[model samples]
Target: MTVSVAHGTARLSAVAGATAGDAYVRAREALTAAGLSEDDIVQVVEYVTDPAAGCGEARPAGVTVSTVAVEGLPEPGATVAVEVTAYRGGGERIATGSGVVTVADEIVYVPGILPADLSAGFREQYRSCLEVAGELLKAAGLGLDALVQTTDYTATATRAEYPHCGRPRRELLGGTGADGRPVHPGAAGILVDRPLTEGAMVSLDAIASRRPLRTVNPGWRRYETLTYKPGIAAGNTLFMSGFGALEPATQRAIFDGDLLAQAEYTYAAIAAVLREARLAGNAVVRLVEYVTPAGIADYDKVAEIRAKYFGGPVALTSVVCSALLRPEFLIEVVPTAVFP
Candidate 1:
């Protein structure tokens, strides 16, 4: 489907396959079918359950791609889920752009970091990733202050490690130079069984824009530890924080073990946030689903519930990960939508 934001228009599509390699080819073909050439494509996000899945090789030259490893997918035995987002107009490339690439003045891709030179440790690895992210933003002629949303993938992250995770990000991206203020971006963290990079504890990616941004938070839910808004809207695009099956008032997970129920509740939460932003589910153009090992067995059930929320075709990427922020949460859903 087509999504029109303030800077440009994006066309999104999804391709699936029995194997990662095949899915990569199909994804390219799907992008071609959607009328996007190699250079026209902006970003690709691949979800895989297997660490060996070679998603990087599938990416076209000059396009930024991020592959996330998860616990399971809705398609049984499927190794890769590919989602493509291509922009039709309005963006520029900086002279020294390196790992950070900008698309349509809205999205930025920070390539996953595999710091082979650095000693293996969570703090070191995470710090290195943030360093790279900062370099990327600088290369794109932007800074940490321009970021409106971010996503982090980690091998093993716990509530205790949450602050440690934020420490590096805040140090790098949370301050306004010469203004004495804090830059708060909408953020989401995913705990994967394994990351695409070996010995890497965490990888960071983000979206930034020059357009004005406003945080969107429903009055019902509250966060005790994490430092992220419920959602953020920039121009005509909305970036939602990851949603789980937690009760709005209680902040407790509902349907602890039931995948379908959890999926429904997650969608309900997403819808509520969308409503607060003056948007709806059908406006969504991108969806990312993270499922645990137990939840992977019921992937189809989760898909069935997803179909009930989105009306048109959406670029969907599903992955099976080891666990979530909370043990009881079987699934986490992240969505992006465009408003008129």
Candidate 2:
């Protein structure tokens, strides 16, 4: 079996203007309560409505921090949500720049990548972002081809223009795959409440490895033209993009406005990807469930469906986004796994 990866998350509300520090403390305490230490954390994503509230220097030095600016957290009055990904093999230690990376017993997490030129538009900003990512990974003896997954945070105001990112993305990521097509990384892109930096249009989070990255498709040709892949596998891990219960060939959503039905179809689709990766449900290490406002009513029942597919405890994080890719897509499930 693959070595276990530990995950922890917590959300907390503080007095209106001062939420970041308080929430950060509560999150650390929660992880500690669950038996995780700061050293075990390889990746940390702080979802906050307020960008000014980050822990800054107070954040764990060895962790790669991804800041997520959301409209609001799921918890009422909660200003921040802290999510952590940790490895439990007990050899996690910092090897290079403190905030840039963390090597663990089983994985390497190189998180947030944002352009220093916040004044740059989407294209320039992303170009800068990719440059830094390449530098970081290259220094680690890897390349964009080593990336297994990516998360995108784009300004809500520029959401319509975000697709333009495809041009640059196509140019940078794909190393040399079939037909000269790039073996793109699995990804999830969402609209943030505001810009990441002062005027930055986009920022990103990624996971990579020194091992050769490979695409894991469920025999679907729909992604042949797009820059995103259904899943990417590197080392012993598989990273999947957010998937809803949609007909892969026709691109029609299978279940609309029904969380349970959508959840069923979504998991089945996930099972297909797992099969493509030569893995079982028990290989899953973490999951992030993004739900739309309409899906909240049926959220509780999702657990029952999860238990059916997941053989052991799976680390989880859930967020209620302002919206999903489609009105009918009540929920989108993102799964990451380590092979057994």
| TM-score, per-candidate, Cα-based | 0.85, 0.84
Best by lDDT: 2
Clashing pairs in 2: 174-182
* Per-residue lDDT of candidate 1, residues 1-340 (tens digit): 2332323555554566677677878866766675656666667677776768576565666566666776666665677777766666325544233443755755655554444334557766777776666677777667776677778877554445655766766576553412333335777777876767656667676777766666676775364234566777777788877888878677777798899888898898888888998887788877877788788777776667787888777767666777777779888888888787
Location of the lowest summed lDDT over 10 successive residues in candidate 2:
8-17
**Candidate 1 worst ten-residue window by lDDT:** 174-183
> What's the lDDT for residue 241 in model 2?
89
Candidate 2 per-residue C-alpha lDDT over 73-174 given as tens digits, one digit per residue, 9 for 90 to 100? 556677777776655433344454425665554355776777868877888887788777777776566777767677777755776777788888888877
Question: For model 2, what is the C-alpha lDDT against the true structure?
Answer: 0.71
Which candidate gets the maximum TM-score versus the true structure?
A: 1
Model 1: what TM-score? Answer: 0.85
Model 2 lDDT, residue 330, Cα: 80
Candidate 2 TM-score to native: 0.84
Candidate 1 has an lDDT of: 0.68
